[model samples]
Target: MFAPGQEQLSKEQIKAGEIQASQTVRSAVAGAIMLYLSPFAVDFVKKFL
Candidate 1:
């Protein structure tokens, strides 16, 4: 009865948490890639300009 409703709520909460964790990881990876590549990009531009 009421137990099923509570269980569904818990499941939804777990899914939301997982989605948030994935987004955070993706952002961190994107930031790291940008950080690593930015210096090379600047040097390349400087050579042309």
Candidate 2:
């Protein structure tokens, strides 16, 4: 028979994996947005200083 604790542990592991995957996707999107916007930001800052 499977141990009682094993099922809970497996569920926790699946939840953790989903959280990690979502974070990874969010980071990728943020990075891409920053990459696309950086040039305009740099020019804007340069105009002030």
Which has the greatest TM-score?
Answer: 1
Instruction: List model 1 lDDT by residue over 1-49, tens digit each.
Output: 3665553447788899999999999999999999999999999999999
Once superposed on the true structure, which residue ranges of model 2 sit more than 4 Å away at CA? 1-9
lDDT of 2 by residue, 1-49 (tens): 2776554447788899999999999999999999999999999999999
Residue 28 C-alpha lDDT in model 1: 100
- Where is model 1 more than 4 Å wrong at Cα? 1-9
Clashing pairs in 1: none
